[model samples]
Target: MNFEKIVQERYATKTFDGKSIPQSEVEKLLEIIRYASSSFNIQPWIIKIIPDKETKDKLSPASFDQPQIKSCSHLLVFCANKNVSENIDKLEKLMIANGSDPEKAREYTNMMRDFEKGMTDEKKLAWAQRQTYIALGNAINGAKSLGFDSCPMEGFDSDAYAKILNLSSNIVPTVLCPIGYGTDKPKPKLRFPKEEVFM
Candidate 1:
């Protein structure tokens, strides 16, 4: 598909078809995220997949009864790690795959860790969240490429999601992306004019 078409047609889907998202397709979407670019390649995003009806029900209330919560076929929760440097080895692997030599990979990886360590808690968490957004973009576009609809959400209660998934202190939920087929037409998306926002 042309890039412009992807951008123009990608809207936040609200009502989803009852059709379930295939596990394989979701996995492929995740694969897209795994290879997404991140700030300094710290790459600290984590994804939690909720497929059970019980779990979805628990999440629905947290989302303030957002219809997408219960209407979508699958729920994906992305969290940012407070201590992403713990995954140095994983980051190194990604760097190497992206064309870094072994020595360069090690040196750059240490630099990223040090940069993270120098940040205040709020800044570090914010940076981690920024990385997750990159991954989210990749996942959303990849899903659309394969003929799926998604609702990118941050309307849920993070604490509720953490408790529902039994996530640890270091991993905090950042965003939710529900993927499935759409049953209803997307209402026209309103936005500021490009010239007003761009410059």
Candidate 2:
């Protein structure tokens, strides 16, 4: 399907049929999410995929007992990785390994490091969380492109998620996305006109 159709047809799925998406398809969708844009290519996000019913059951209450949590085939927990300096170092190494000139890679990574130094911990987390949303955008759109359904949800307890998932302090849960075959139909699109949205 074309991009326009995918965007127009895709909706925040309210409920999903209890069906498992194929592992191969899930991986493909993940690749699409991985390619999401980030500032300076820092890519400060980690996604945790939950496939089992037991864990989803546990997470449902934390998600305000949302039906999507338990009904969807898989739940993707997007987290912001706050270890900005470490990621900058890793990116530099990756660049050199992929045939980038070592000197140029170091120069680029040094620039990123300098940028990272200016941000406080709070700012780093906020910035990383913003980047995580870009990936989440890809996930919802990619699900539709792959003929599945998805919901981007933030109506949850982040602290509870961090505790239940046993995530590290640096990996802050930013958002939730549940993907599967939608049992519910899409409602009409309620969006502002282009003229109203644009300045």
Candidate 3:
């Protein structure tokens, strides 16, 4: 589908049929997310895929008893990786493996490390969270492109999710994307006038 059509056709799915998206399609959607851009190419995020109904049942209460939690085929918990330095090191290695000069890779990674060191702990979490949203954007749009539905949700309890998922201190759950075949149809697209939205 064209980009315009994808954007217009996609909606925040409110409810989903209890059907699983094919594994191949799910992998394609993940590729789209993996390519999402981030500052410094640090890629400071980890996604936990929950396809088990039992876990979904456990998490729904934390999400205000939202129906989407249990009805969706899969839930993607996008977590911001607080360990920015580790990602920087991994990126440097990837660069060298992909034919970048070793010295240049080191130089780029050093720059990223310096930038990360300058941020406070709070700043690190905030920055990572912001980057994670970019991935979430890709996820919703990509779902539509691949003939499925998705809901980008922030209504859940983050702390509760972290505890339920047993995430480390460095992994902070930032957003949720529940993907499935929607039982509900999309309403008409509503938006402000183009003139008002664009400067």
Of 2 and 3, which scores higher on lDDT? 2
**Inter-residue clash pairs, candidate 2:** none
lDDT of 2 by residue, 1-199 (tens): 9999999999999999979999999999999999999999999999999999999999999999999999999999999999999999999999999999999999999999999999999999999999999999999999999999999999999999999999999999999999999999999999999999999
How far out, in Å, is residue 150 in model 3? 0.4
Pairs of colliding residues, candidate 1: none
For model 2 the local lDDT of residue 196 reads: 100
State the displacement of the C-alpha of residue 57, model 1, in Å, after optimal TM-score superposition: 0.7
How many backbone collisions does model 3 have?
Answer: 0
TM-score of each: 0.90, 0.99, 0.98
Screening candidate 3 with a backbone cut-off below 3 angstroms (N, C-alpha, C), the clashing residue pairs are: none
Residue 174 displacement in candidate 2 (angstroms): 0.5
The best candidate in terms of TM-score: 2
For residue 123, model 2's alpha carbon misses the true position, in angstroms, by: 0.4
For model 1, residues 1-43, the per-residue Cα lDDT tens digits are 7767776777788888767888888888888879999876667
List model 3 lDDT by residue over 1-199, tens digit each. Answer: 9989999999999999989999999999999999999998899999999999999999999999999999999999999999999899899999999999999999989999899999999999999999999999999999999999999999999999999999999999999999999989899988999999999
